[model samples]
Target: MEDQFFELMCEKSSSESANTSGRTEEFLDSSANTVDISENEEERDKMTNFLQVIESYTDQEFRRNFRLNSSTARMLIDRYNTSSFYTNKEHGGLPKVGASKEIYILLSYMANTNTFREIANLFNMSKSSAWRILRRVVEWLLSIGHEYIQWPSASKVQDNMRKFKAMKNIPNFVGCIDCSHINIKAPVSNKHAYFKRKQFYSPQLQVVVDADKMFIDVFAGEPGSLHDSRILRRSSIYEKATDDVESKFPFNSFLLGDTAYGNSQGLISAFRENGFLTPA
Candidate 1:
């Protein structure tokens, strides 16, 4: 009888040990699942907050931050959506960013000097993703730039001339030409060529604007160390004007430029004062 009791106790202890092991495994699994769910909720909340912050901005604030009004931003988003480049995935990988968000990211990059990492964090994306979106958006805008920026038609030139005459009492004035310096990092080749008088490395952008301050022509990629006259001579507009002034300056109109541009067939500059001019 004592031997039978000892065997029964051993069996009972074995059963209890197996049950405890099973309960421990179940608890560990439940804890792991809880951690996963918590992480997912946190990510969702972050996205929600990011979107809400943007949506709550006023019109002025939106323009200040994005460099464009909300309506114009929406229009760009719609336009981007119509292109083949607009997609939510690449071969069924992680979902791609939407058009609206991509545009905002591009504009933010343009309107500020924020680093890619900062921009990515603000938009809830990775640095590489921000770079990719910028490349796509910039290429799209460049592809369509010619449609918006071009020499005025003959009639349009005449209209612009009239506006210039009325505004500044200058006859046959069609547009204003000027140069601006854009800061850039030192290039690996010919670093000195990009260093300007302002003690920084940069590139120069030459633009022609009509009376309405709308860009009619843009020429860039010249080193900042170069003079305005040299940049102008290197431009296609100069080549065309020098070849056939009538082709570019219809109605005998001319562009007003600063002294840096000197004088040309289709351009006029202010006379330098030497402090020896007699009253005429």
Candidate 2:
């Protein structure tokens, strides 16, 4: 543009050059002004190109990705704008931080780490908005997950254990007890406290699963601070003295656990009570 302006100025001033020095001053001013104009025009062209790229997104593709049906999208957004936490009995209307409806829908598919950004891109929502919705849905799920997911009783556990007898050297089992871990972010302070003896940063989960590996009953959620031994001692399953209770189980059935569990009354594991689990 500067070059073009200079060329035009030169062409216009060529005839004037024969007149006087005043013409040179005027021409220089005109050339300088022309350069600014050309620069502004170039900038405008660049802006136009940028805007074109932004606008190039196909409406069809966008609508599909964003789940952007006008009525549904507006309703969901409005619900988020007005609605509060589903778990909060006290606080009525809208989740405290992340309860946007669009995000909640995304979480229904979040069996894995599939990201909020991907969801946002698909849903045509802001990443932050998608993230908030996901969070709230998770909280909501957690809040009610327990009531729906229940702990089975002793007889149920006993009945399932009989099938394991089919496996050689396995018998009289009610359930298998073990520890699982829940993933979490490291806290800023006392990092070691959350860390398990396994040297991992996860919450320890104590579960009692039947022979088929279906969860019979569980100790539920607990921090990693305690050891497997202490966790069992404190668990309601342990306190119930399930093994000692006289039940109608054939041979007064029992359960199994790792060597981590020492001998307890009626609770049978090869680690603690050998012959109870040994094959017929």
Candidate lDDT scores, in order, read 0.68, 0.46
User: How badly does each model clash, as a count of residue pairs?
Assistant: 0, 9
Which residue pairs collide in model 1, if any? none
Model 2 worst lDDT run, 10 consecutive residues: 1-10
Error (Å) of candidate 1 at residue 118 is 0.9
Q: Supply the TM-score for candidate 2.
A: 0.50
**C-alpha RMSD by candidate, in order:** 24.9, 26.9
The count of backbone overlaps in candidate 1 is 0
In model 2, the runs with Cα more than 4 Å from the true position are 1-110, 115-119, 139-148, 151-155, 188-190, 197-199, 242-244, 247-251, 272-280
**lDDT tens digits, residue span 139-243, model 1:** 555545554566788888999998998998889988999988877666555669889999987667777888877767767667799999998998766876889
How much is 85 displaced in model 2, in angstroms?
A: 7.1
Candidate 1 lDDT score relative to the true structure? 0.68
